[model samples]
Target: MEHQWVLLFQDAASVREILSHLIYLSFVLKDSPPLFVKLNVAIILEVLRYAQMHQLFPTFSLQTIVFFSLELVRVTTYEEALGQAINLQKSKLFCSRNTLDDLKNLIATTLGVRQVLGTCKYLGLPSMIGHSKHATFKFVKDRIWNKINSWSSRCLSQAGREVLIKSVLQSIPSYVMSIFLLPGSIINEIEKMLNFFWWGHNSANSRGLHWLSWERLSVPKVFGGMGVKGLKAFNMAMVGKHAWKLVSSLESLITRLLKAKYFPRSDYFGASIGHNPSYVWRSIWSAKDVIRRGFQWSIGTGEHIPVWDHPWISNVARILPSTHHHLEWPSITISDLLITPEKQWNMELINTFFDTVTARNIFNTRCFLW
Candidate 1:
């Protein structure tokens, strides 16, 4: 088993080297968009798939015939497709707590890796997030503390500390923040650490007078306060950037995938946090407010824009027109009001359905057919 594992690792390294060369050659040879790049990568990946399938054919076939024979009629393309081979020495297999011991053993032996309980770190963040979001994300707080502790507050002037705090301390959890909404407790604790460090206190035990609140510090320098980012707001903005992408890039693959899974019936703006949502989905959903506040739908086809639900009209004080009076009218799209082919708004229908103010606003807004 050990000899076979070593051979497998060597083979994996050779395959990686081949892939790197291929990728470099592809980039040098083809000047194309991201979609074409992905297609090129897919073609390269087929090499790995075949290599892995060749190596695992006998064992996989036996396993399929024995263990999963009833569960799955045949192995899926996804199962056969190439992925990064696990390093038996460094990699650990994580399974549900309730997973049977026999199944765990089978997986470990098959994969040549050890089984681990609880959770483990992957690329500085938890590979799996269990309940207790605070506990799961507590590492971010610890990381901030460690970085702050390493610095000497007494040696540096307030100016120096400010730069360090902004550049280093605040940026420690940015990658994590971009993906996950840090628990309020973790954010508060991290802010407290930053507050202490900024006020010339070396440690939590040291006392320093806090002349201004962290909020004031977080305010823009143009607003007569130091330009330090508020973690909570910054996190929201970072995650909201991705949410904004979903709104803007309707044809993107990720947008399509998320739409299919989370909000097949409605658009992204109207998506709900459906049952058993993923942490990624929840984090993105949390920032919907950030996107909503700034997002005004530009008139395109208007087929997707809901007249009652969407914020299409910027001329009015409220982006979304008041709907209390028109509750009786069925839900309608902006396109529904248009006389098609000519793509002109049907003033008769608009005047019949909407109040004078709304009808006027609809007419005032321009819609381009092209």
Candidate 2:
């Protein structure tokens, strides 16, 4: 049921709560009925109302395989409300290769659908991913190349080509990039196509002099180059935004769901790539460097930030305290450094464990409780 809802509002936050539950269905179901094409927020909300009234939802643990039997019934309830049924003939049921044949047949028969082997595409992105990531995301490169070749660059001025590249060509893979981190190779290939387009080469085989490297052109115009976005940097920024959300927007359903599985005990910055991590987790984790460099804990009750380990000090080259200043208070939190009740810095205790420079930095660190 994962759909690209265009002609809708620019942000998805308006319907995010209602759609949050639908994430499970993305893993369970590959295609939506024709009715989905015409759906607006109002129609979607109406459908959810019918679903709730009928008690179609079954409680299940997050990140676990959804019991298809229960979800299929929910789909039936949706069909009844929408007056359109799932086209089982055109639809596909993707399952793990390790799935038992008998169970697969039972579920497929129950839903009246065909079981497809290997990974299937849902809205042009792979529904299931494996180790061969580059192969899995080759569609991104192909899509960009196809679009670039189709456009006739012969008649357009350099300015017109710049607009086309900025507006249409770069946006082609944006949706996919937002979800998954495109491989470096694919990003390079896409940039190569864009570079050619910018310099008047319309086809892959055609040659044009690339006067400035893409990195230079991607710099801001103020820095003596075009303000074209660097694909690698842009992809990281897009994925890092999600990582930041997991920290800032704690109560969000997506945050809760991801936290439950990956970082149950630790925050996003501290979370590890656990054994057999999903592609989604890996993609998000890939931006950990970006998050770590930019992340600064806002000291609230000072409960979360570690005194020695975390980056809490602002406007410094190295936010964490230097290893030269060592202490055995591994269990200490930033709260311990505060004179509680007043919530002011404990200057005497700060000087006891830290060097002169380090002590000054600690005093300068802002505390919200104060």
Candidate 3:
């Protein structure tokens, strides 16, 4: 088994083939690892529970809201020995007879009371805003909200907040990626995904309860917001911890120490040896692509934070002209003089000529406008 598993994905073609079969391969991989099998069974069972819950009781389907809660438990449980038996038992309790009432009762016990008073869990005010359940964006007005006297506000239980963050971080990527994968104007229509079906937060006069209404906070800072991050951003923020491994990786004293003490190459899941990396390392790497997409922030030249008009990128006023630009600035191309100076001088004419020249020369772009 070791030898076969080792040889399974030895080449580029194999990696591509495996990626193509990622969904199927995931199912196949459940058997080999003894540790995760029990809990994975739990996850599969919960996934089914939620799916059925959604189908049967759309009105009461807070199931997907808490689904992330289960996933959070799975990833962080660390030791199968601690989680498997209890969680597995929880599944049986849920499916004892496969009736909605029994499932609801089981969920009530296993999930412990916080059954989300409003519509769905994700649709909750804080959750909708991409905040941890702990976050509460209250109206600066509203007699009820205004009644709270101090910024030194009481907060929700830290436990609930953490679970909220974990759930949102894990679930948002699939939505963001699926949106980007669509073609043409379909991407533009992605705003429909943000349409509000409902919004409410706990009415308790606690700090966390402040995030009740959608009116006070949601959009973004530029759109006049406190710039409270969304789930998509938080998800990347969480995934970024792993991505730092690949980016900050080095063969140094610190890395060696980290490897030896906390995550050894041998014992650690993600450590790379020759070709194969450890599982911990691989998970971080897998998350990199998602992080890359989630982490859209970047620093550009001239310390200019780009506006929507130039949000894609902004040019920096270079203190030191890069060698390639100062030295090799494609000086005076033959076509530069081919077009009449009058023609070249016209912005419209120049744009057409530049496009043709760039396309013909295989430059992909021609932004030179001296």
Arranged by lDDT with the best first, the candidates are 1, 2, 3
Question: Is candidate 1 or 2 superior in TM-score?
Answer: 1
Global local distance difference test of model 3: 0.35
Candidate 2 to truth, TM: 0.74
Which RMSD values do the candidates have, in order? 11.2, 13.1, 19.3
Error of 2 at 154 (Å): 1.6
Which one wins by lDDT: 1 or 3?
A: 1
List clash counts for every candidate, in order.
0, 0, 12
User: Would you estimate the TM-scores of all the predictions?
Assistant: 0.75, 0.74, 0.22
Winner on TM-score (2 vs 3):
2
Candidate 2 — which residues are off by over 4 angstroms?
1-91, 100-102, 323-327
What digit string (tens of lDDT, one per residue) describes model 2 on residues 6-85? Answer: 21222433335435444433334534443332343334454444434544333321111123422554576588788898
Ranking by TM-score: 1, 2, 3
What's the lDDT for all of these models?
0.74, 0.74, 0.35
**lDDT over C-alpha atoms for residue 157 of model 1:** 97
**Superposed Cα deviation of residue 361, candidate 1 (Å):** 2.1
